[model samples]
Target: MGRWGPDARGRLEAAALELYTERGYEQTTVAEIAGRAGLTERTFFRHFADKREVLFGGSTRLQDLVVGAVERAPDTPAPLEAVVRGLEEAGAFFQQNVGRLRRRQAVIDANAELQARELSKFAALASALRGALLRRGVADPAAGLTAEAGIVVFKTAFERWLGETGQRDWSSLLRESLDDLKAVVAGDEAQADPP
Candidate 1:
């Protein structure tokens, strides 16, 4: 790829991931990433604020997707149901990017700072979901509670999905995780048995 490639951001992200995987994230530098991508340091800065941003650049886009799903959800569903709708949308997104996400998760798992940032990202997503639910006429505690619960479901489902061998789809895993949550909340005896 040329320095002025059409997918400068994609190239930068790929390059950064490659370097971060090959050499530790802390050991990689912006100039090396730019060189690997056939981009200049200036081009890298234009696409991302710093090396850390490479991992987090898509967070805003993901947040927007979830919030938009929640906003467009039908009014008949309960707050948690509406939150599930948003999570399902996010599941679709994750399904399409499983490979990249797995690699990103590996990178994050290897670094304490990245793990902290990942938690912050989830917190931000929860806050965004709460705001969307509130805008959809949900009450304060319900909106907050539902949003937090949805994030928990999402995180649990996502971890399970990552650990699986791709036999199941993202939506199914999400629904199953949600079902498990509901079972636990309702004190279902069946949940006591190992699955």
Candidate 2:
């Protein structure tokens, strides 16, 4: 049993990604990750509850951070706008960690189990955003739709963010997604209105 150093958690995550890349996720074990990081199995567990969680590490913290930003924003912005802005505010965190984030995403993308877990994480985050929207007095379909739209926007923005290096910020990508969604929805509305 060894102590989990201050960098132990991040080190484990990095090692897990490397191992996942070199040997695939199914072939990589906690002991191997621990050994790679010069940590003990006990220390690995201390940092990540399980293997699947290594890819999902810090997501819960990130979700809370974004939601907190939404709650703190002035009540003037529309529900969707508030959530998008909250997500945008989280750009600082993304910028700070994009390299590791992208590497983790690559590992997850290469594994079906990890992708399923990633989808579940996205669903949970969307649900949390919906709850936050409802708390702001948005009603019914609006809240659900706004939250869903925010998730779509976030996803699109994330894809673009990962496509580029640090040259583009998350907020710009988010705004572009929001605008694209608005255009798509507006066009659909026009077509449905019997123009």
Candidate 3:
């Protein structure tokens, strides 16, 4: 993140997403992406293995960042709070990079293959998040439920972030989505309870 290179990984990621949207993911080659970004193809390959990788480029690193956040959070944090805290930690990666993400999301929303890959990546992140929670000694059902809930918050926050034309914060939106999720859960529970 800190000055990876003259044509660092982030620039490549941005260039690839823009090209993927304009040219279509299937048609955009690594060479073309690198060239568009004024970088060598080797630089592109170094950052991303293939075109699809560009769409999901930050996921692995984001997963790690979120896990680190989980580990760093207060020991007695609630399950939902823990999830939001983890997401907040990871949100830094997207704070100034929403444009690239919106482009990638646009491409993914339009392409079934990309959408499927996005689904798979999300599942993988959920699994990783669940593991992180358990590693911190978070109990069963709560850990699994919180992980899924965290994913919902991330998707919702991301979409809300995309809705805006002007710059805004990701963490605030992320937190609000989780809060809304809690409200929904509370309402559902109330409906289920007898009068």
Between candidates 1 and 2, the one scoring higher on TM-score is: 1
* C-alpha lDDT values of all predictions: 0.90, 0.86, 0.81
Tell me the tens digit of each residue's lDDT in model 3 across 53-77: 8778678888888878887788898
Instruction: Candidate 3: give the clashing pairs.
Output: none
Rank list by TM-score: 1, 2, 3
lDDT of 1 by residue, 87-154 (tens): 77877678778888888889999999999998999999999999999999998999999999999999
Q: Write the per-residue lDDT of candidate 2 for residues 39-98, one digit (tens) a residue.
A: 889988877889889888778888998888877888899898999989987788888888
Specify the highest-lDDT model's number.
Answer: 1
- The Cα error of candidate 1 at residue 154, in Å, is 0.5
With candidate 2 superimposed using the best TM-score fit, by how many Å does residue 148's alpha carbon deviate from the native? 0.6
Q: Once superposed on the true structure, which residue ranges of model 1 sit more than 4 Å away at CA? A: 1-5, 189-195
Against the correct fold, how does model 3 do in TM-score?
0.83
Ranking by lDDT, best first? 1, 2, 3
Which model is ahead, 1 or 3, in terms of lDDT?
1
| Segments of candidate 3 deviating more than 4 angstroms | 1-8, 38-43, 166-168, 188-195
